[model samples]
Every structure is written in structure tokens, then in C-alpha cells.
Target: MAETVKKATRESFGEALCELAEQNKDIVVFDADLAAATKTSIFQKANPDRFFDCGIAEGNMMGVAAGMAAAGKIPVAASFAMFATGRAFEQIRNSIAYPKLNVKIAGSHAGISTGEDGATHQCIEDIAIMRAIPNMVVLNPADHWEMKAATKAAIEYNGPVYIRLGRLAIDSFNDPETYSFELGKGITLHEGNDVTVIASGLVVNEALKAVKVLEAEGISARLINIHTIKPIDRDIVIKAAQETGRIITVEEHNVVGGLADAVCEVVTAECPVKVTRIGVQDEFGYSGPAWELLDAFKLTQPHIAQVIRDVVNEK
Candidate 1:
């Protein structure tokens, strides 16, 4: 097998923003003094006139993006997940979501994968907060290709969108040439009848790895990638629950309000099944290496596989 290309989703977001800006001049980008880290600097370099640096004020950046969106420009506000969704949440709720502006909020370095930046920087609750807002569309792309596609889709979409981006470099699983991105839809990567693993963001790759391990042990695991968390693909989730007696949700975020919550809502409403959520428990992350953090939090492939195995074995 050929080696898979690895790239951070933030890098994909920046490159996609630059590419989309070339096609649509209405696209504008705003950063809160962390463009380099968020990779929005790529857009700043390519479109200097359209890029605005809002110092260290993430809230102010969100307000500016809302104002720009009000004026018919597609404004993308980029910042760390903790600051973008945590600090500027009120601005995003009142200024952007209230009026239903076409502002695209990109939160990079999301989840515990933010590594040594530690608990202060790691954001595990952005998904829950963003999804709670009335007019917000939550998107959490899994791989480099998915991020690029989702970025373009968010630009074309005329509403408030919250896109979660990651800092960890992950293997590219989707083929850019063959991949087609649709909003509010889930992609089934593997087919199985026994159990279903619904996952998003960085954990999608881990879910894929766990599938191989389960298959070797005579378990058939279906893998679903939910790129859009809000307006989740309810039909696919309901179908998975109906066909597969057991369901496991894997995410790089907190188990409270991320992918697990979304899947549970669907399963509880439609076809009830035994749903197991694999993610960070309700707690802040600590300072550690990215891979180490994943293991410590039990987000690794073996951990994920074991959870699925237990669910399958449960009578």
C-alpha cells in the first residue's frame, strides 16, 4: 500500500480559503493575532487587502466578521477553538446567530490534540456551544480533503456556520478527486451489519483503524463520518441504529455535547440502540504530547476497538 499523505486540517482550511477567495472576491478573512498558528496566514498572504488582524480580541474579530457579513461580504473569522467559541460566544450568538448572518467561524486547534498548549488552549466543548445556538450550522470535517471541501461548502452556504479545525497532522483518508462534500449528510466509509461506529474530526481516523482490528476478530463494524454535526444526518443515523444493534460514537471532543450527543439524540428519537460514547469525559485536558494525550484520554485505536468489542459482546 502507498503511504498516506498527512496534513493538518488548519492547513487545508487556509489553502481552501485562498483558493475560494480567488473565485469569489466577496470572501474576507479575520484573525485574532494568531493567523500563523491557525493557518489563516495563508489567506492573509494571498489576499492581503481582504485579511484583517483584530489584535488579540477574538470577540471584536467576531463582531467585525458579523458586520462584514451584514454588508454582503462572506467573512470568515479564524481563531483558537477556546477563544473563538468560548470567549466570543456571546458575540457569535448575539451579533451573528441572532440576525442569521453569513459569517463563517473557523475554530482551529480544537480538542485535546492541541498538545502541549495544555488545558487552557484545548477546547472540547465548542461543538456543544455552537450547536446550541439557534441559527448556527456546526461542521466538523475529518481529514484534509474533507476540510477543503467543507470550507468551500460553508462559503457557498448563506448562514452562520461554525467549523471545528484541528492542529494535529492526520493521515488523509478521502480521495480529493473522488470526494464530494454535501452539507448535513453523513458518509459511510465501511459497511457492516453488526455494529456502527459514528465518528467525526480527528477521531474518524482512529475509528477507521479500529474497524480493521474488529474485523480480524470476526466483528463487522460500519464506519460513518459525520462532517456536519448540526442538522446531523438523522436518516443515516436512524438507519444505522435500526440495522446495527450496537452503536459507538468516537470523537476528539468532550462526550457531553459533541458527536456522541448528536448521535444519541437521533437514536433515542428514532431507533433506540445501545450507544457507547468514546471521548473525553467531562473534564479539562492537561499538558502532554498529542499522541500521549490521545492515549491518556482513551481516544486511541486500541481503546476505541476495545469499546466496540465490549459493546458487541454485551448480551
Candidate 2:
């Protein structure tokens, strides 16, 4: 048998959407003229009658999705992260979140990996914006398996959902044949007592690598993958704090409202653990390679491991 190649987040969105459409006839897909880029075109190709093109108007597309949800249809509105989160934010909050509609907003080309397109196309603040909306379930899947599982989970889940996907090829984490992902659940990747690294999305891949680096340095680093941002796993974070004593958070998003902030909110209020957040520190990114941008923002594996060391030493 040939070895199976894992798909990227973009590929996961394509596969998941098509699979869900096969099971549910009332599932409709709407794209803001970026179907190809957002990977919603996969659904469009499979079910042309059920897919809609809302042109470049993301706000109107969001409203259309909310209306579809009201009529008992599951509508997935797809667009770029910046446009979906920044441009259609009002519609998402008012039309979708306000009513707690069963609509999934899949934002693609997120973070600096959208790259070369420059700062205007990137969305470092998406997590912050979506987290602020009441009744919104924010999810940033770390790999192909998680992304597909999240899309399936979103269908059964009611209310508004924001599922962020990346444009670049993402790393694989979970087993595609067996791993099951649940919303608001955190998966512990590695166990250790020296320090804990809590991360979500693309940064989780780097954190996993950091764990190997720490092992070579005679440090046992705990790795926790926080896939769901909203309704974050409190128990996992608290347990990490109690076990590791020191905690550091990593995310491709800004430190403000992303995984870092979400973990900090839990640890500070309950455990009061020594926590350090490794992410973009309230600054915009410049045009560069995805890895370069991560390095520039101090979100690389070395930076995360160093932060883990610092946080552990602080205690």
C-alpha cells in the first residue's frame, strides 16, 4: 500500500464541505466571489445548484447565510479572513450571532501565510473579533484532520460558527483514520513537569517541534493543542498549570484575543500561573515568507521554547 499524504487546511475545507453536502441536502454554500481561493469551490463543483456566488459583497453574503439558516438550511459563507472578519463583522454580529443562527463562516487565507499579499490581506485580529461576538463558536484547527472534524462538528452545532483555515500548506498532527475532534476540547500532545506550551492553529505545529528541542535540552515540555478558541477548555488549562507550574501560549494570531489571551484568561482568574504569550504583540506584519513572518513575530519554535524556559525559570 502506498503511504497516504495528509491534506492542508485548504484541502480539508474542500473535502469536508463536499462530504457534508453529500449527507445533507439542505446544506448550501455561499462564497463572496472567492470560491476558488476559499476552497468553497469544491462544494460548488459538486453541487452547483446548492452553491451561491454573492460576488465581492461579503456583508450581503453573511446576511444571506443568516437568512438561509432561519429557513432551516445550513449555510456556509466562505471568504478571506480579513474580509469575513473585518468587512462583514457587523453582519456576522447582528444578523448571525444576535439571533444565534446555524451558520458557519469559513474564513480562508488567514494569518501571514496569506503572505506576499501584504498586511491588507492578512488577519491577525480575527480571533479577537470573533471571540467578542456572543453566541459565536470560534475554531482554528491545527491540521487537516482537525479541520475536517471541525467542519463536521459545525454542522451538528447550532448558532454562529467561525472556522478559520490557512492558505499555505499546513503540517499534519492527528491520525486521519482514527482521531476525533470535539469542540471546546483541548488535546494534550506531550506530558511533562517543567513547562506547558498551549497553542492553536499553525503555531501548534511549531510548538510540537519545540517539544523535541526541549527534550534534547533535558527539559520535559508539555504540549496542549487548543483547537477551539471560543468555549476554550478550562479544565485542560488549569490542569496544565497545576502540573507544569509554568505556561506559555502560541498562536498565529495576535496575543490579544487569540489562543494566548484565551489561555491567560483562564489561568489568571483561577490558577494564577506564571504565563507567557508568544505571538504577534499588537503589531501588523510586513510582506515576507510565512516562515519569515513567523520568525519576525517571534512565533518560531526556538522562540516558543525560549519562552517556555523563561516562564519556568520565573517560577
Error of 1 at 30 (Å): 0.4
Instruction: Please give the clash total of every predicted structure, in order.
Output: 0, 0
lDDT of 1 by residue, 1-315 (tens): 334769999999999999999999999999999999999999999999999999999999999999999899999999999999999999999999999999999999999999999999999999999999999999999998999999999999999999999999999888876788999999999899889999999989999999988898999999999999999999999999989878999999999988999999988888888889899999999999999999999999999999988888888
Which regions of candidate 1 deviate over 4 angstroms?
A: 1-3
- Name the best candidate (by lDDT): 1
Q: Model 2: per-residue lDDT, tens digit, 1-315?
A: 223345569779888999988888989999999988888888899999999999999999999999999999999999999999999999999999999999999989888777788899889999999999999999999888888899999988977899999988866867777777889999998888898888899888889988988888888999999889999999999998988788888888888888888888898898987778788788888898877887888878888888777776673
RMSD to the true structure for each prediction, in A, is 1.1, 1.6
State the RMSD for candidate 1.
1.1
Off by over 4 Å in 2: 1-6
Query: How many backbone clashes are present in model 1?
Result: 0
Clashing pairs in model 2, backbone N/Cα/C closer than 3 A: none
